[model samples]
Target: MSRVSILALALGLAASSLALTASAATPSANTPSAAITAAIADVNRPQADRDRDGDRKPAEMLAFAGVKPGDKVVDFMPGAGYFTRLFAKAVGPKGRVYTLLPGELATRSQKAVDGQKALAQDKAYGNIVPLVQPVNAPVFPEKVDVVWTSQNYHDLHDAFLGPADVAAVNKAIFDALKPGGVYIVLDHAGDKGSGLRDTETLHRIDPETVKKEVEAAGFVLDGEDDALRNSADNHSLKVFDPSLRGHTDQFVFKFRKPK
Candidate 1:
């Protein structure tokens, strides 16, 4: 090859390599999923909220849930607006995040209603809509793309739910989602054979039980993510136990409404 042509080709290859390196180092504006990027860049997020990211794996969990911009999501029992704020931002301006305050929880503690109401009025979470309803007769204004419940599924059996017909709650959720919608459940894991034995005391439920109950609602188990799992947890201690408070082993399950 001519010397000029050879040099030109070498320069072209070097430029291509640099471009590729730059692309890899700095993801394009379109590269990181909107949901993932928003969760990371949410400056209004409190320091205490950021502090829990290590253990809660909010980014990983949202990615697993397949959350995206312009999606309508329901943050089931959005206690203290933790994931509520993230979901609100994840869905962006065109989308909406409904933070549910079940009557069972609200009637028991006015704090639940007050907290969610405060979030609804926050200009930072402009896309959040507070949904207040009785646990047994829960409903949504419109079908949603995703219904997410984090660290609170076992509460279905809590006395506060009072003869809680978990089936009804599940059915209400099933009815409120689009045919192909997603349901993401993240909760502390109980021992393999524990069943509901420890839910009230230890605040943990067997992953198998959760799957079975959710599947019975006519939803299919789409996938499971162990990003928050910790094999070190023995499943005996309460999730609130001082030793395992933030390190409890948890399971993340994704269920899909049949299309």
Candidate 2:
């Protein structure tokens, strides 16, 4: 063959090899990593929890948050230990998961405390540590990779929880995470411009408000996933309005502490 013909043949072979390698590394159709999928499929997960998988979308959320095996995680105010269980599994044997409950609630709500304690004691959830702390402090035993809270950020302003200092809470969360760690907040969305007005009543907050306050803590707005979003929500009714209880307009925001 001529020199030019030989070079063309070599380049084509190299390109073909690279394509095969790339395809091998990529998961198909958004499936999570094998470790994550294994955690989600663990037979030990509570049957009730498994039933809710359709709506909670645990695998999608974990995948988006970049939760990997052996990454320390904190489930902030993990009521009833729903996500807490999943975190424990995702972190696996080498890692740990902490369930931090608002101190007041831990002391006052026996049921909530009991549920978390039970999970912590379960052999299958050996990686979990249950803690009680004031709403104002996002205390953790050590800096962790991810701090996750679902459907509860707005409660910081509730008369029952705070009028808690949300800014201080955000700062505490920032301090508790290692550099480049993730903070995942999932909550119901209020009407545009609603601000904190509807937090206590409607149990929702404007997504913009949440973004601005969290950004002020010096963390970067990494990305947002709208997998849980529901445009059908009118945003006027309370989250428990019954009409829209199970399906509310929600947002999943992922923020990163700069490395």
Top-TM-score candidate index: 2
Clashing pairs in 1: none
True-structure lDDT of candidate 1: 0.87
**C-alpha TM-score for every candidate:** 0.87, 0.89
Q: What are the lDDT scores of the predictions, listed in order?
A: 0.87, 0.88
Q: How close is candidate 2 to the true structure, as a TM-score?
A: 0.89
Any runs in candidate 1 off by more than 4 Å, and if so which?
1-32
lDDT of 2 by residue, 119-201 (tens): 89999889999888888875678999999999999988887685788889999999999999999999999988989899988
RMSD of each: 5.0, 3.0
lDDT agreement of model 2 with the native: 0.88
What tens-digit string does per-residue lDDT give for candidate 1 at 9-81?
A: 9999999999999878985322447567777679999889999888887777777888888999999889888
- For every model shown, the clashing-pair count is 0, 1
Q: For residue 68, what is the lDDT in candidate 2?
A: 84
Candidate 1 least-lDDT 10 residues: 27-36
lDDT of 1 at 115: 92
